[model samples]
Target chain A: MTKISAEGICKSFAGPRQRVEAVRSFSLDVREGEFVCLVGPSGCGKSTFLRIVAGLMEATSGRLEIHRDAEDGRPLNSMVFQEYAVFPWKTVSENVAFGLAMRNVPRKERDARTAEWIDRVGLRRFAHHYPHQLSGGMRQRVGIARALANDPEILLMDEPLGALDAQTRTVLQEELLRIWQSRRKTVMYVTHSIEEAVLLGDRVVLMTAHPGTNKAEFTVPLERPRTLQTTTDPQFSRLSYQIWEELRDEVQRSMEENA
Target chain B: MSSGGQRNRTREEDGKAHTGAGLMSPAAGTVLLRWVALFVLFNGAMTVLRLWEPLWWAAALVNFVLLVRIAEQGALLVPARFARTYERSLAVAFPLVLLAGWQLVVGAEILSPTWFPPPTRIVRALWELATGFDEFTGTSLFGRPWEIPARLAEDGLKDGAAAFTAESHLFATLMRVFAGFAIGAVPGVLLGMVMGVSRTVRAMVDATLSAFYVLPKIAIFPIMMLVFPNPFGEGPKIAVVAISAFFLVAINTMVGVRDIEPVYLEAGRNYGATGRRMFRHVIIPAALPVIFGGLRIALGTALIVIIAIEFVRSRTGVGYLTFYYWEILSPDKMYAGLVVVMILGVGLTTGLKALERVVMPWRRDPGRSDPGG
Candidate 1:
């Protein structure tokens, strides 16, 4: 079933000197329970597009929709931000329970679900600790747990592991795959890393730089239950390299535009 | 093997030479002797130049430098294990040295005792102020706390309350500070929050608020007096304090709220926090650290404004006591009043710090491992 559909979506910002187009005529169709990764160069508006889908930002012009089941009481989408936007004031359990608390979920259910997610993220020991007390990787875990605990129809991630160290990133990637395998939610993951996209997503959608638009798409032929060891697979390397070839030109173009 | 043995012998000789050189370097004993000689030389020069007033000050300046050098050397001589204690002691000792110098200068009649009374005299004056009631002003510094129980027993609640009334300078000042702080801070924070959240409100009031903020709060005392129904009452004085505190807190709170990370707000909105929920879960908690910062600044401003107002208008406050003592040419009493004000400032700031800790437990130093963790 088609869960998310975007047709010719455009977003522009009014700059100090001129109107800057960020995303132009971006289009994608995401299937239910399918992990779709949007890979692009810097300033490609991949994050902006994700924000639009999350309802945090508005598209200038387009038909963008997340088809919801009338019976489902969960939120349409919950975002895991690039910066690990966990509340510094709240403990891990509280941050995980934030969405449920906002929805006025009962105390018993909220605590149970929050505890469950905290354990899922391997943050059970730090459940009572604030975001500032946690490391970058742990903080991102809280962010992921928060989105998952919300039980949203679709999980929107914007470079969720982008700020972490290489080892931390790899560990989280495995954890993410493990979590997703258990509860397969529709996800739109935006990343700059081709390998991450190939490793995580069932389909990788490449975007052009500077006023981003869809350029190419590649279906990941890798098997599920993927691990860090999967990156060593010959097909994984070949697919990552192929995506890099398409993305290198756009990365160069972006650097020039920025200059 | 012979060449290696020679190299090892040279290395041993080098280590011995290094240790010998270290031993020759100015040890603590040498430093102490040097400091002692300098101290005596400076003191002797100071004694000789004491007859000449201009040269005496120059000698005193030289002596002061020597004293500081001695203190630094003394600190270095302290063992590493007692470093923290030594540091604290140095802080206390420096002030004591200043006080001793003050005593000597005044005692020797280098400075007039009447105008620059020694610290001993100030302590005596403070004790008198605390203990004795002034017949002339019909007031005291702390009121008769010892008489409170007796008065309550004899006169009951109505007259017993007199013991706690604003007859004491300290009590009056405290009441004004607390009352004005609450009056100003509450509305200031609320208005600041409103202005922070709404750009229209911010634009509307920001300019006028800034104008009022920069205008010296003391300059508006007369205006506040005129605004109040009774110009001579506590109302005008408290109002002036409130106005000063209001501007500081409001501006700071607004900045605090506005400075909240946009990403947090986005996350809040995305996670279904709206209206009051948004405020409680996101905005207020996020802005709390800054709000406390504003409150702390506002509190300090409130104290300053109140003290200044009391100096001009109040008959029963620490400021009034200080100024009155000056008018009476009682420098000791005036110094005592200043001491009280300093104590009050420290006490209030400490209280605010405690409150800040309680309000924002999340901001505690991350170095301290949490009990839960």
Candidate 2:
């Protein structure tokens, strides 16, 4: 079953002198429990498209539908943002429990679920710590845990580990794979890293530079339950290189457009 | 690679040598000795020649600089383990040294005792004011704390006994400050939050608020008096105080709300936080640090306005007491009242700090070790 169906999505912003088109006629279908990564250059509007799907931004013109299963009490979607948007004023457990609290889940269940997610993210000991008290990687863990604990129908991630160091990013990618394997939640992941797109996604969708639109798509040939060592596999490198070759011109075009 | 290793080793040695030189610098001892010698020489010349009065001031300034440098050097000598404690003690001791110097200057007849009263005399006056009631003004500093229970017992709760307990200068000033603060800050924060969230509201009121914010609140006292029915009573005084605090807190709260990172708001909305939930979870907490900053500044302003008002019109406040002693030409008692004001300022600020700590546990210094990793 298709969990999300977005067609001809176009987003534009009012600039000082003209209407700046951020995304143009983007169309994609995410299957239930399938992980899809949108790989693009800077200013490709991948994040804009994700935000439209998240309902944080309105598409100038589009048909977007998130298919909800009947009798499912979970939310339509929950997003893990690029900035690790965990509340600095809240503790680790509190931030994880935020969505549940917003949904007015009872205290006992909230605490139980919050604790489980905190432990899963390996932040059990820092449950009472604030975001400032945690490292960048640890903070992003809280962000991931916050989204996952919400138990949404579709998980939307916009460069969730983009702010982390390379080593931390690798570790989090493995953790993300491990988590996705267990639950098999429908996820829409956006990233500028082709390697990340290849490592994590079942299918990688490439986007154009300015006025971003779907350019191409590729199926990941990597095996499931992947880890850091998967990157060493010959197939993974070949796929990543192929995606980079397609993306290289788009990155150059984006730089020129920005200039 | 070998050359790189040798270069690194040489740099490490140079760093160590620099640190060693800094710690045992020969100039440190000579610097202090030079200053002390200059100070002594200047004072000796002043005493012997009985030079110009301006030259005496210059010698005194040299003496003051020498004392400060000595203190700084002395602080360096303290062990690292007790460094913080030593610094705190020096803060207290430096003031005491200044007071002692004042006392010596007065005792030596360099300064008139009547004008620049010694610290001991001021302390004595403070005790008297604290303990004794004044028949002329019908006021006291503490309002007879020991007799409160007896008065209440005889007069009962309904029959004006509460007035006796609230009769002191300190009590009057405190009541005005707290009442005005509460009255002003609550509405200010609400209005600020509204303005912060809504750009239309902010644009509409920003100019008007800025206009009132810059006007000296004390300058509007006459207008406050005219607005209040009982101009001579506490109404006008408190109104002025409330107005001052309101503008400060409102402007600050608006800024606080406006300054919240947009990503947090997006996250809040993404997580299904709407309206009140958004406010409670995301908006309020994000803006709290700045709100508290505004509150602290507003509090200081409130105190300043109240003191100035008391100095002008009121008869039952620390400001009135200080002004009264000035009128009577009792410098000691005036200094004592000033001391009480200082104490009140410190006490109120400390209380606010404690409240800030309670409200903002997340802002506490993160000294905890990473137990997870």
lDDT of 2 at B77: 49
Candidate 2 clashes between residue pairs 3 or more apart in a chain or in different chains: none
lDDT of 1 by residue, A4-70 (tens): 9999999999999999999999999999999999999988999999999999989999999889985
* DockQ per candidate: 0.49, 0.67
Model 1 chain B: which ten-residue window has the lowest total lDDT?
B364-373
C-alpha lDDT (0 to 100) for residue A89 of candidate 1: 92
Residue pairs clashing, model 1: none
Superposed Cα deviation of residue A112, candidate 1 (Å): 0.8
Off by over 4 Å in 2: B1-53, B158-166, B371-373
Question: Chain A TM-scores, all candidates?
Answer: 0.98, 0.98
Task: For candidate 2, give the lDDT.
Answer: 0.89
